[model samples]
Target chain A: MRLITLPILMLSMFSVSTFAEEHVVSQKNKSFSENKISINVGDTVHFLNKDPFFHNIFSLSDEQYFDLGSYPKDESRSVVFDTPGEIEVECAIHSKMFLLIEVKKSEDN
Target chain B: MKTLLFYFTLLVSQLSYAAETEPTDYTFIAGHPSLQQWLLPTPIPTPKDNPLTAEKVSLGKMLFFDPRLSGDNNMSCATCHNPMLGWSDNLTVARGYKSKALTRATPLIINLAYNNLQMWDGRIKTLEEQALAPMEAELEMHADLSQKIALLSGIDGYVTAFDNAFPDQGVNTKTMAMAIASFERTLISNNSRFDTWVKGDKSALTADEISGFKLFVDPVKGNCAVCHSPPNFTDDGFHNIGLASFGHDNPDLGRYNQRRLNLMKGAFKTPTLRDIALSAPFFHDGSAQTLSDVVEHYSEGGKVKTNLSPNFTANTLTPEEIASIVSFLNALTSPHKPFTLPTLPQ
Candidate 1:
């Protein structure tokens, strides 16, 4: 019973190592699903436009900067947080739509 | 097998009952509970740093109407934001310092207290930041900041008013901006025929006006309610609603100047539609001459469609329907109040 449990734990650890963290932030009703989120460096955050209208995602942050141009409903864009810092994400069209992302250093690094 | 059949029968009956309860008439649409979201909030939201006070309001009112705040000492904020003309100058485009014709129209100061951003392009984030802009701008008031502050500091009447408004802070740019913003916060409009109708008065709107409202909300119809939302009638969002001026050689970049995004190239902040009828020659460029002209432009899905907002579409509204929408817009104006001009301090 001990041998079987040890192998199961090792396999789960391997699986976790192979997959990088990915988060989905949906835009609906001119707002983000989450106002803020935390993730490790190299983790990807996907912005999904769920509203009928177009939404543009961009960040003029210190560590990471990106401008995902406007896209219509059902479309999505992803950005990888390369640095460990706070990034303010906002929709260009809708000024009120704002999200803050806290990126931490990867433990493996 | 017998239990399965019984459950299926129950489900079918429930579905039919639900179908029966679904809204099917105009009465249900007109009196929907969701309509209550359109009511304006009271007691007005103010920043914690600059809470509203009678002293601040009075001081701000004097500064707003005082021409001595300018470089030439002839033009005040009231020169362009005339209270009689919907708090705007009612010009095709604003006349700035030395009677220079500006590129944009003088936007009404009405209900600006509720706005998240200021100016047509939304460059300024707060009213405090906005109050000092025209005075400092070369084309507007053209006042030197230090000189203006010095002038205010020397005046005993202004110094006393500033002391009363800011208490410990005394006379300075920051306190002056806060006081002006506090006064501007008082400029709000919550009373209108449409407001009364929203507040449970069935007789407030005519049948034609009600139909126009339906058209305004309908996705396939006028679709005005998409941007001009409830209460304040502004979504506080920016859009490049294709205007004819956008086709010009050197068209204004608007929000693009601030954000540097292609989508925001010609985008301008969506202004409040409350009392919109009074502030005519609409659009950021002051292109449309009248309200009908504005409706007509939207009906065409915008003449210059390049880079047009995805939200806009060719509205298939008839002449009568257009007139009805105009009639509904007319009901947005609140009853006028006799505005007494503030006495300038010597």
Candidate 2:
């Protein structure tokens, strides 16, 4: 019974790792491609710049605050969602660009 | 003779139609399709809640020009944003309440309708949000809102004007801001020679001006368009374009006060270059004296490089290139139309 329980616990832990997903959000024409996106906790969001110029994506939100600095065209910056809450993201360079990220708890959790 | 005149009119109409139907895909300079982005959009953007009306504009103009709204019953918005002086005071730094010089230059009110953000720090999001800021600021107009409201409500002319403008809204700060914003929306500057050139008038700009324009867009050359983008000539972005002022102790942290980001420190909103030739003594600190001086600053890649904007890079533009760029900037000036002053309410 103990051996069976250990195998079941290992399978559950492996499933969580396997299920973690990555989402792509593009910055084009000084605006974020997605106005709002929903992602589960442990998921990663990749911010890709498609514009000719640079973009500095940052979020001052209490839930996962980050400043990606500035990256040029074709470059990408990523952030992993560890907390479950709404995050408001914006470009430091262009105030017009905004992205709202909704991080939800993983189904297993 | 009648037949000839009719044929001439028909021919002119056909030519106009042809010009209008011409594909926008055609490039201004060879290999630069991005130049088409320089055309300004028509019908200025306004909040749906506060649509522009003649009555509103009239009321706003009165409020804007009326000095009675100030704490001292003196110094109207026009005192700093004077129309004769390019909608700016032409002062190095703006003089606030009681003739105290403020830290930053009084930003021009030109083409503000297109901006999604307002003020040097972009602390405000709309012109309506920006209108009452000076009137309330301790160092600016410094008007006691309660007293000002009482005074305006007392005036029969103002009461009638406000009623005409806002109907059921009544005399209040919101309506005043909305009215002032409505008037400011009319301050559009999109008819410059460069605009004419963008509209396909090849003859509008001279050879030197065209060359200067090419240099302005060339990433390795002028690279001005990277920040001072198309149409309104602003990217609606903020940059810490390393001015000597940044080197000063306790330098103005500009956008950082609102944004609280390390990059935002010393960053300020990128001002429009539409009527660049008009407003002199440029930059937030009013550092540069002339267009040439402005170009020189960029050529040196800003004075203080410690926290320079990532977008800025030292360029190697020659004197000729600089002159041409300045000439191109001069082409951005729209012909000044005579402004009719609004009659103040007694």
Candidate 3:
């Protein structure tokens, strides 16, 4: 059957290039066990600091603004969430840490 | 005095050190309160999700001295911050909103509770995002924050001060910039006379302001505590002291426009000489209009050296040590309260 329809169209383009959207964003009880979230638009989000001290995530928000400039303690950083709406992220050396991502909209035609 | 305001709020909540280097000098001694050996802790930048109240600091001091939040009700925010001139606006440029001038000038909200960043090109890092950068700038105070919150939600005395100030997240623009940033976080400064001579009070200052506070902590004389440090003088950091004298011609990379690094070219924000002899024509383009021309532009270390700020040029004082570091920076100025003005909500 034509080699099983070309191996089911190459396994649907390898499951849309292994889609992503991860999270952890902690700095130890400084809040953000998901202050707000939603992802899909080429997903990717990871901040993991889990306090022992050292963090700086930063954002000027209008839909994604970066400034990771200093991270230490169980290290991590990804951020692909490709713009959509309602961002509001933070850390800038812990002014009480914060979060809010929500990307959505990318179900492939 | 309540055991000296409980040892000065346990010296500004344990300015505990070891965040590495940077804590230059001045404060925490005599009846000890732990300015953590001269200030550092800062990290309670309050975001465990924006918490701060007192009916959002009394509706952010009536939207910081209302004037219909500007667009020609004739400016407010104490018309360029004027808690009797210590909140700065002694002007060197600032005017606009049709009065016209602005190249930069008008800063001083007092000890921004330990500044991590905000303006003079630190590009807003909260004060509820630096109170909407002078009302949607078109040259300051242009006002249009969603038609000034739909004309202050059709005023009925701002609908009872927005129903006793946010009775559950009311009247928008992020709760009117977190209620004028919770009345600019209680505009804190902590009593001066160099904090009653750092609390020992040996006749609080005057011995040439205690040899200009021992040559402002002599690091080779008036090293001005390596960037106006201690008990909040300012190490809120950012340099490039050279003021590129009034003509400007290129290079204001400051804090490298949010750190692109290049020794933060012609950097800005290092203010806080605390109520700095009443915020007069100083740098960030006010071009040092006198504190002996900003101690002769740091005694000549800034006249432009293409990318200066190696602790900004021309050192080795002596005019009796720049008049004892300008009489110990006029004892770090600050005290002028009595407000009153506001009254527009009708």
Candidate 4:
């Protein structure tokens, strides 16, 4: 029973590492690098601030809600998309910056 | 000789037109590429749906100055946003709805055409969206939209004017807002001393004002450009600059009202400093009476440090530096143009 549990845990870890991917969206010139992007569920998106000032990126979408408190240049914050839907992201500081993310159901699911 | 005289006369007319319509040459700031961002783009941005037109501007001007639109028939858009008062009321807080003191100061509408968002807390997205807010607010204009529409429609002059401006739209709320926004778009303030300097005029700014500009952009010194950025002298961003009023119990939660986040608790929109000198009594609360007072507040970081904007920091600017910064701000004022009062449709 212990041997069977260990194999199952190892298989789950391998599956996550293989299926999940990461994407980077840069914040520069008071705008997001990508206006819209598509990624599978369970994938992570890193919001990198490339501007000189600070930016507070937040999303109140029902799919994935998050508030990445203001961070300065070269810093980055990330979030995992667990649900399959659209998420609209915006900067609390600069209203001009906006981003939309489409999370599709993973093929494995 | 007759043909030569005609050609010479045509040349003079063409030259005058070129002088008025030509784009500014930004080669003067070539030494500092960073300062290039300070130049405002010409032919002001306008929304696609609400394009500017002479008829619309004329109708909007009349509506903006006509007091009959208000509930008491005493207040117009120009009452609080007086052209003589730097497009603002010049009060600590606005007097709204029968001389009642408002919670916030009347913000100047100058150069709002360049803003991506509107209002102190950034609740509205466009000038068109914000045009009727004061009229709708109970503490403000307190005008019934249905009644105002009926009143305007009853006037034969207004009816013709609206038809001319909006074609098929008539005298409706949407057409009224679009017309007002079209006129507001014409309130451009890009011809300041700083603009002249950027346009290759070396004598536009004084020596001390130049030094002030340097300190204003330096991160360790005045550091004002972090939020009050270039072009329009605004980043179109929001920040909580730590005013003393933020410490009061049940203090105003500015941007947090729209976007619920800890960082936005006291955040307010960063206003354009294009005509900074003209619009006296600074900040949303109108606490700073002078530019010197404003510099002092920034030097001390802020009056209330809690929930302060991450972009702001304590500076060690000397008295001379502060004075110089204030001098630089004084140069931001554009020469006022004569505003003609529009005749209202009776």
Candidates in order have lDDT scores of: 0.81, 0.85, 0.64, 0.84
Residue-wise lDDT of candidate 3 within B1-346, one digit each (tens)?
4333333332332233224233333343443453333332343345545576676777778878887777886787778887776777788867868789876787777767567677776678878878877876878888888998888888887667767777756687888887787678677666667666665765766777667666666556666665665546665656666666522666456567665544555577777776577777777777777776777667666676766544443566777778867776777664566666546566
| TM-scores, all models, native as reference | 0.88, 0.89, 0.28, 0.89
For A20-61, candidate 4 gives per-residue lDDT tens digits of: 676778787889989999989988787877676789999999
Report the Cα lDDT for residue B46, model 2. Answer: 83
Candidate 1: residue B102 lDDT (0-100): 91
Show the lowest summed lDDT stretch of 10 residues, model 1 chain B: B17-26
Model 4 lDDT tens row, B292-331:
9999999988989989999998997789999999999988
TM-score of 2: 0.89
Residues B1-346 of candidate 2: C-alpha lDDT, one tens digit per residue: 4333333433343234323322222355522455667878878888899999999999999999999889898989999999888899899999989999999998888999999799999999989889999999999999998899889999999999999998998999999999999999999999888888876777889999988988887778998888988778888999999899999999999999998888889999999998878888899999998999999899988988887778887798899999999999999999989888988877
Spell out the clash pairs found in candidate 4.
none
**Model 3 / residue B201 / CA error / Å:** 3.5
After superposition, candidate 3 runs with Cα above 4 Å error: A1-109, B1-53, B58-101, B111-133, B141-143, B146-161, B166-182, B191-193, B202-209, B213-284, B288-293, B297-320, B330-346
For model 3 the local lDDT of residue B50 reads 57
CA deviation > 4 Å runs, candidate 2: A1-16, B1-26, B29-34
Identify the leading candidate in terms of lDDT.
2
Q: After superposition, how far is residue A52 of candidate 2 from its true place, in Å?
A: 2.6
lDDT of 1 by residue, B160-181 (tens): 9999888889888999899999
Docking class of 3: incorrect
Clashes of each: 0, 0, 7, 0
